[model samples]
Every structure is written in C-alpha cells, then in structure tokens.
Target: MRICFPVSQEKGWESPVFGHFGSAPAFVIVDTDSGQLEEVTNGDLHHAHGMCQPLKALGGRQVDGVAVGGIGMGALMKLQAQGITVYRAVEGTVKDNLAMLKEGKLPVFSSDWTCAGHGHAGGCAHR
Candidate 1:
C-alpha cells in the first residue's frame, strides 16, 4: 500500500509531518511494499477556508491513504470520495508515521475527526 504524508519540508522520509493538510508545503508519498518515496510540492497550498484541492497537491500521483496531523471537513470528505483513506499522523517525522501506519497503530480519520477550522486548533495533537 502507498501512503501520503503532508510534510513541512521535502526531506523524503525524514521530513516532519505538517499540521494541516491544506496548507502543507509539500507531500511525501511512500510505497510501503517497495519502500520508494516521492516528494511533490503543494500547488494548491494556499486557498480559502474549505477550499482545499488535495488532488492538485497530489500532482497526478495515486495514493492509497493520507497520513495527516489535521484536515478540514471539506478536504477530508473529498479525499474519502476519491477512495483515499485518511489516517491520523503520528506525532513525528514522516518515517515515524509510516511505521505506525504499517503497524496499524494509527487511527483512521473520519469526518468527525476533522478540524473545526483551519490552523490545527481542535483536531490534531501535534501542530
């Protein structure tokens, strides 16, 4: 399975996971089976509230899941509609979250788990 992580930097697996999905600077996509990594800049990173276009950030790559510290309801719903599962990120680097995901220790994010608004106030533990 492949997992996507919203990261603050483009340091591959070493990058720390960004707090909010819509405003993350970049995304790290990792292939669990092959251990391959891809980094892409977030083209739609700046947008109004409830207007995140996650597919644009994906840059045409397909991912099985997204591991994020926080996501708004609209973005979360959009991702689910695209068949992408959302997972709560572990409070660390991309590598740490990936390990937790592989171990099935991270919780799957649902609509109720979405942030009340932008800026990671009510949803995520690590911001």
Candidate 2:
C-alpha cells in the first residue's frame, strides 16, 4: 500500500504532523512493501483553491491512502472523488506515522471530522 503523510518538518517520532492535503509543505509517502519514502516538496500553494498545486501535482500516484492532521472540505471531496482513501487525526512525526501504519494502528477517517491541535489556519474546522 502507498501512504502519504503531511508533516511540519522531518522531526523524530515526537514531532506532530500538521498541514492539510491541498496545501502542505511536504508529503512523506511510504511504500508499504519496501518501506521506502518518496518525499514530495511543494514550493507554491497560495491556498489557491480546493485543487491546490501539491494535490494536483500528485496525480496518478496510485496511493491507497493518505494520513494527515486535517483537511478542508474541498480538498476532501476532491481526493474522495479520485477514490483516494483519506485517513486523518494522525499526530506524530513522519517516522512514527509510518510505523503506526505498518502496525495497523493508523487512524482512519470517520464520518465525523477530527481536527484538533492541527492549527487550523483556514478555520474551516473539523477537517
């Protein structure tokens, strides 16, 4: 399985994950089979629209899921429309998140949004 995680910096396990899907600084993608990481650096996002630059740049990556702290309604809908499974409420560093995913302990999305302590700058809330 391919998994993407939105994070602040490449801190250790204690570092918490942040940033929304549409407008994240970078995304750490893990290839479950090989445990290799694909780092995607987003240079520009402007909070332009729901289909932000980063997300659009991720086209056809064949990711099975994405782990993030929060996301907006527009981004969520766009990702869902592409059949990409979203898993939110994930806190911890990039490495910890990967381990959690490997252990099947990763938090998957529910009908109710989970967006606490993610610094919801957009203020959309409950992303």
Clashes of each: 0, 0
Please provide, for model 1 over 77-110, each residue's C-alpha lDDT reduced to its tens digit, 9 standing for 90 to 100: 9899999999988669999999898899999996
Q: What is model 1's C-alpha RMSD? A: 2.8
Model 2 C-alpha lDDT per residue in residues 11-44, reported as the tens digit of each score: 4343356656655666677788986777665544
Off by over 4 Å in 1: 119-127
lDDT of 2 at 120: 36
Q: Name the top TM-score candidate.
A: 1
Q: Which prediction has the highest lDDT against the true structure? A: 1
